[model samples]
Structure formats: C-alpha cells, structure tokens
Target: MTGLAVVGVADDTDGPVVHLVTADERARHCPDCGARARRSKDRRVTRPRDLSVGSRRPRLVWAKRRWRCDELTCRRRSFTESVPPVPPRKRLTTRLRAAAGAAVADQGRTVVQAARDYALSWPVVAGAFTSHARAVLPAQPEPVQALGIDEIRRGRPRWIPDEATGIWQTAVDRWHVGFVDLSGKQGLLGQVGGRTAQAVIAWLADRDQAWRDAVQYVAIDMCTIFKSAIRRVLPQATLVVDHFHLVQLANQTLTEVRRRVTVTHRGRRGRKGNREWELRNRLTRSAARMRGEHVDALLDELSNLPRVIGAPITVAWNAKEDLLDLLATARTGNRSAICCTGSTADAPTPTFPNCSA
Candidate 1:
C-alpha cells in the first residue's frame, strides 16, 4: 500500500476493477553498495488478489518494475519492486490472506466456506488459518484450572491411494479431539489429529510442568482414552464427567426403555395414532419446562396405561428427572448421584466407583 498508487478504475461484470501501479520512485540505491542503478533491466505486470469490495469481488491488476543494481562491487544485481501490501512473488495480498484467516479463525467460518467466499483454493485458506493461529496461540498454553476435552467429526472423510503401500487408505481422519479452557476466558485451547490417548498425551506432554500442575480438574465425556491420558500425564487432576453427556445418556436410556415397553404391550412399534408414540417427545421434556396442565395430563395418561406397560417407562422417566436434580448441585462443587438404572422406586444413594480425585 505504501508504494502503490491507483492508476484508474473500470467496470466489470462482477464489480469495479481497480488498476494500480508503483508511484514515482526516488533514486534507487543498491542494497549492498548504496549506489543508484542507471540501467533498467525489465518491467512486468502481475495480478494479485485482494479482499472483496462489496457483495462481489473486484479484480486487481498491478504493474511493477524490475531494477538492475549497476554497482560493480556489490554482490546483489537485480531486485523487483514491492510494496508492503503486495509483496514480491505473492499471488495474494497480505490483507487478503489476513481477512481469509480471520473469517475462519475469528468469525467461526469453516475453511471451505472461507475459501469459497474468497475465491481461493482450500490449501491457501488452510495455510492462512495456520498462520493466523500461530500468531494468536501462545508458545505454551496458559495454565487452566479446569480443562475440557471432546471429540468432533471435523468433516467428511476421504480415501486416497497410498503410493508407497499401493493400497487405498484414509486421507485424513474424520474425528478430531479439541481441548478447551473451561475455567477461564480463553475458549478453544488446542486440537489434535485423533481422539486417541496418544494424541491427548502428546499435546499434554508439550506443556511445562507448572502448566500441567495448575490443572485442578479435567472434564470430559465418558471416554476411557481421555481418562487414561489424563491419568498418565496429569495424575493430580480430578476427572469429572461433563453434564451434557450425562443428560445425553439419560435420554438414550429412557428412549430405549420406552421402545421396548411399546413393543411388549402393543405387540408393535409406536405409530402416529398410538398414545405411547404421541407422548414420546413429552416424556423426554424436562418437567420444569412443561405447563402444570400438560404435566398433569402426561401423568394421568401414563398412569391409565396397563400397569405392566407403564411401570418400566415411569421408572426410567423418574430416574432421568432425579439425575437432572442431582446435577443441579454440581455448581456448588458437590458430587451427587442417583441410580439411573434398575426399576427400584427409591432414589439411589451416592457412590463413586473407581479411585478418582
């Protein structure tokens, strides 16, 4: 931008195209000898990409000059004119790359989405994001009081031919593990290639001893790989099952129980006209969110069903509600549990199975 000057503007099918050229230069000095070059080598023009002007993208055409440093004693001979925004040999401007990176890293746009919006290749956008991440991330992650680790299916998996093995193999892993700073303002702390214990260990091993020691709790789903890795790396940190997974497990168990009861009593799966099917969604909803009349109606309907058909479902529903109630105490740092299994009407007593912090 410093050395660049707008020559003119023209209309295009997409938007306005801006023409740019280098400003009149003061005497060019040789890099090594500090002497000006009297002879010109050649001149060339390059087209570099920039950020979009509006809804549509504008084209950029730049005319640059190549200079010959005529100082005899100096080792440097020829160099190309460059500006801060549009550097030499770069196809995209600095601002373009920075904007692409920010779209993905800050605005939560995916790499493919940013690349499509910028009319660039996926690799270019991904490289820009890597640069942006390095600019933002610390050399060592800040010490976290509580850490959360989870697995995500990043994108559709691809299979490509493995040249050396002469066989087809997965090009990239679909599953990735993301680490988060649960106890502080920083959101996503790091990500790794796989959801394996080794991957988690590798990331944790990179941290300093003091940073690892500061982690008081590690919150994760019911994943043994993560649990094992935490035990090996940060043995002092307590393992806590996150609330989302607990609620998910409760819902899954309740659904399974309802399906089995429906088949046993009705001699078939739930259909649209079936009362059991009609109440399926209502049963999963939390009691606190339901109106008083709806709650009473739901209770009356379930109670009127055949005792054998309704009893098991009623137990499962009650268990889910009780578990939700226990989880409410988690904010106070209280560990509580209720038996979410078995048909016993009594609430489960507190018990934690394995040795944990």
Candidate 2:
C-alpha cells in the first residue's frame, strides 16, 4: 500500500482479489544511457500473494507498464516498474514475506507452524526467519562475567539399531546442557548435545582464551560433570550452587529421613492419622508460614517420642529449615541494607547433642 493504490476488488472461490496500480507517475530513466523513458510498449498483470484480509486469503493484482528505453547508444532494451512492497518477479509481496518472517522469529513459531498459519511452504518460512534473525541480531557475542550451566531433559528415550553392532541400545543421553550469561544483557549462551563432561568441555573449548578468563564465577547445579569441566577449562572461576538446587537437596534429604524413620518405627508406610504423616507437608513449610501453636504442638509431640525414633526426624527437619533460613539470608542480604546472622562463612557451625562440632 505504500506505493500502490487499489483500483478494484473482486471475489474468488478461494478468497478476495485486489486490483492495484502505481499511485504516482514517477519519471523512469534508462539504466545505461540515463535518458528518460517516454514510450511504453505494453502492459501486463502480475498477481502477488499477500497476507490474509479478515479471515480469508487475499491476492494483489498489479498492472505494470513495460517502458521501452529509447536510448540509441545504450545497450538496455526495456524494463517494468516495481515497488518496495511488491518486488519485481517475486511471487510473494515484500510485506507478506516480512510478516511471515516476523511471525516465525518474534512469535516463537516453528517454520512448519508459521508456514501452516500463512499458507506458505516450510522452506520459505524457514528462510524468512533466518533472514529476519540475521538482519536484527548482533554479529558478535557480548562478554560475560557470571555463567550458569544446567541440564534439561529432552524427552522419552528411543532405541535404534547400531551400525557396527546389530544390537539396539537405549538412548542414554536424554539431557541437554544449556549455558547462560548470568550477568550480561545476553541471556542464553548456547546448548550442547549431552550432559557429560566432554560436551561441556567441548563448548568451553570453542570459546577463546579471553572469554574463559573473563568468566569469574560459574553457577551450576550439583553436577559433577560440569564441575570437573569448568575446573579443567576455567580454573579461575568460582563454582557456586544455585539456591533452588540447594533447597531441592535439603528437601530430598528430609524426605529420605522421614521415610526411613516411618518404616523403622511404625513398621509400615506413612498413612493418614499418623502424627508424622499428618505433619509431612507442614514439616517443610517455611518458618514464616507455620502457625505458632501448630508448630509448638508438633515440637511437643515429636520431642516426647523416644530418642531413637524422634531424634532422627527432628534433626533432619531442623537441618532442612536451617538451610532454608541461611538461603533466605543470602538471597535478601544483598538487596536489603540489614544483614541477617552475618556472613555464612563466619557463622558458627551447627553442633548436635553429644556430637563434635
């Protein structure tokens, strides 16, 4: 519509067709001789695909004039008029291709998905997205300070026959490790094939020495493979575990202790009406969310059970809550001016009854 004016509209079985012409009579000069083209040979109509109008498909019909370049010394013959929105000899309009590209890139749609939505082919949509990405995205990556490494589960494992040995082996690497720039504007760095040390090492090795040296701190889950790889590649970087994984480890430990205590004391699985079972959910609840009286009751009941039965559960629950409290401190201490319990490094180590600190 930038340089085109709609002359007429017609209905078709598939959708609507719009007849368009150039809005202005701009002077056209011969490309080689630089002489104004005054004579017109003939006119032809070309149809270009467009985005859907309303809910129906739309097509643009353009009547272009073929101008004969009358430059006697020039080697050019004739040329046709084209606009920015509708390029010459292109089946799809420029606006339509740009729209499809934006749909695939900005909207996070797959190539096939965008193709189906726009009634276009798969390769066309893919090309559109790739072009859009290259045009808008930066050529070089930004420097990173803190890096985070984590694994994501892909999907159900599949079995395929091995070429060398005819036996089919189950796909063991169902996980992909993703690296992220924690401190910079760049979000995700990249993802590698497997969750092994070799995959992590390979990705780290691909980066230049300056990139490895710039990475001062690395955050990762309790993944030994990642730990070993970073140690070998970026030895100067400090490896720290995220609070979410720390909380997960604490919860898992608490659950194991609770299950073991229940089986040993009650001689069966935990069920309703049992004091421990009833308090299961509340046991992990943060101290802020716990009701004072219910918590006091829990303490009174659990404290009375013999040391052999109640001691383990109480110790495990206390440890979990303590870690949660420490995590809360570290998380908020940087934001708030007031620091809770001081730095954990200088904090007193937890000492249990009759156990050396």
Instruction: Give the Cα lDDT of each candidate.
Output: 0.82, 0.78
Identify the leading candidate in terms of lDDT.
Answer: 1
TM per candidate: 0.70, 0.65
lDDT of 1 by residue, 146-178 (tens): 888999998877889988999998778889999
Tens digit of lDDT per residue, candidate 2, span 12-100?
99888889987745525554576778999889899889888789987778887888998778888997776778766788887788888
For model 1, the superposed segments whose C-alpha errors exceed 4 Å read 2-44, 50-85, 99-126, 272-274, 332-357
Q: Candidate 1 — worst ten consecutive residues by lDDT sum? A: 348-357
Clashing residue pairs in candidate 2, if any?
none
Model 2: C-alpha RMSD to truth?
9.2
Listed per candidate, the RMSD to the true structure in angstroms reads 6.4, 9.2
